[model samples]
Target: MKQQILFSFSLFLLTFSSFYYPINTASTAPASSPKLAPAPKSPSPASSKPLVPTLPDTSDSTTPDDITKILKKAKTFAILTRLLKTTEIVDNLNSQLITAKSGGLTIFAPDDSAFSNLKPGFLNSLNENKKIELLQFHILPQFVDSNNFDSLSNPVETVAGKDPLKLPFNVESLGNSVNISTGVVNATVTGVVYQDNKLAIYRLDKVLLPLDFFPSKVHASAPVAAKAPKADDHKDKSSSAEDNEDGETTQGQKKSGAVSFITIEGTRTMLVSLGVAFVAVAMI
Candidate 1:
């Protein structure tokens, strides 16, 4: 009976200890395993900006105002433009403008109507040198504005030279009106075509006819008329016979042929025809 009680007490103690302590399932997990990290996210297309193109810079580019271009654009100076080209004064004026530092040009530009008002055969009567001089006579080497006419003295020098007896001209200002006298005809400044500090162009009512061109105004003394020489009755018939025998003209015959050659009138007519044709073609 004492042995059975001792064994029963020992078994009770063992059951009581097992019931007080429980088995841990989390502690049984593997300690060697590592934790995994989450994946990174991609960026959205809506967050980006668009690219733009750049433009070119052209702030400093500018063109010059040429004389011919100005006249051409004006449309009334067509005949004058043709004359300028024909005389090559356009090239000379452009070059002068480029080379001259302080000097500029003032032109009394005659319009097509002014040219039309000229007497017939007047332009045709001028030789090539005279034609150039005629154009030059209308120009002043220095620029003169319409307001400054009062400041100028009489006998204003021109590109054609200011000879008191010949090419001398006078500029008179009455209020706002300007009158130019060449001792042959008086021309009024009708209007201002173009004006800059460097260049000045004025509209003229008529072409400036220099005093040298008009003998009536230039010459103070009237000359006596030349008398016709009396014909010689005596003749060298032997020399004439020899020339006729040789079938050649004598000196007298040669002189007669020269007298029958193109006269000033004939030349004037030819030039008038040519000028008419040229003007017609240019207008077309």
Candidate 2:
């Protein structure tokens, strides 16, 4: 009975030893496996501000060097200062003239005397709206000199307004003169005396009528046919008609001698009157 119990115990020990040995061997092996790290996130899109455009400085660099130099000169400023004293508008005009780009332009600069000669309250009456037109009249956009005046026809269009001012170019053997055709009633004349680079100055006798002066036609005159007849023409036609009528009366009286003197005179007078009427009608 003791031997059988000992044999059972030996068998159980052998089974336990086999299982324990395998488990211990697995735990003792080297740790060569890679570590599990968190997945890397995609980088956020780059945040950047939009660029802005800048404008060039026109006031400082764009102005021509020559124009800048001219404005700085003492003599030029002195002349301009004197012009400004007369009226406020002249000062504004001076500024524009000096700064203007060099282009062929004829400027009819009015003097203090010219403004003084203007009709009462004329300068004061000019409103802001009309000022541009008045200024335009004095400026010819194209550069024109004294020499160019001869080619321009009377009533040349000005910047002043749509109604072109009649500028009649009168050329004589000596030289040329510029006359403003105001129409049959009044005519104003100006003479171009000074010329500078892209600028011409004219001395005017009177202030030109503002473009708004006449509603019918601004500075336009009647056609030649509408003009009044000359004095000499009137006299010649009257004398010629009287002479023809007298001659007809004398001839008729001689041919009708048999008629009574009174009757003859009456008949001759009527015929003479008819002939004179025909002559007068034809003359017209």
Best by TM-score: 1
Q: Backbone clash tally for model 1?
A: 0
What is candidate 2's local distance difference test score?
0.52
Model 2: per-residue Cα lDDT at residue 262: 71
lDDT of 2 by residue, 1-284 (tens): 89999999999998888877655755698978998899999999752322111112212333232322332331223322343344354555456666777665565555446666667886577666565555566566666655555555545666654443443222121133344543322323344334466555555555555534554554344344566888988789888887788878877877676467778789999999999999999999
Give the least accurate 10-residue stretch of model 1, judged by summed lDDT: 50-59
What is candidate 1's local distance difference test score?
Answer: 0.76
RMSD of each: 34.9, 24.2
- What TM-score would you give candidate 2 relative to the actual structure? 0.38
- Candidate 1 stretches with Cα past 4 Å from truth are 1-65, 221-284
- lDDT for residue 265 in candidate 1, whole number 0-100: 67
Clashes of each: 0, 7
Look at candidate 2 and give me any clashing residue pairs: 104-142, 104-143, 105-143, 136-160, 137-160, 155-166, 155-167
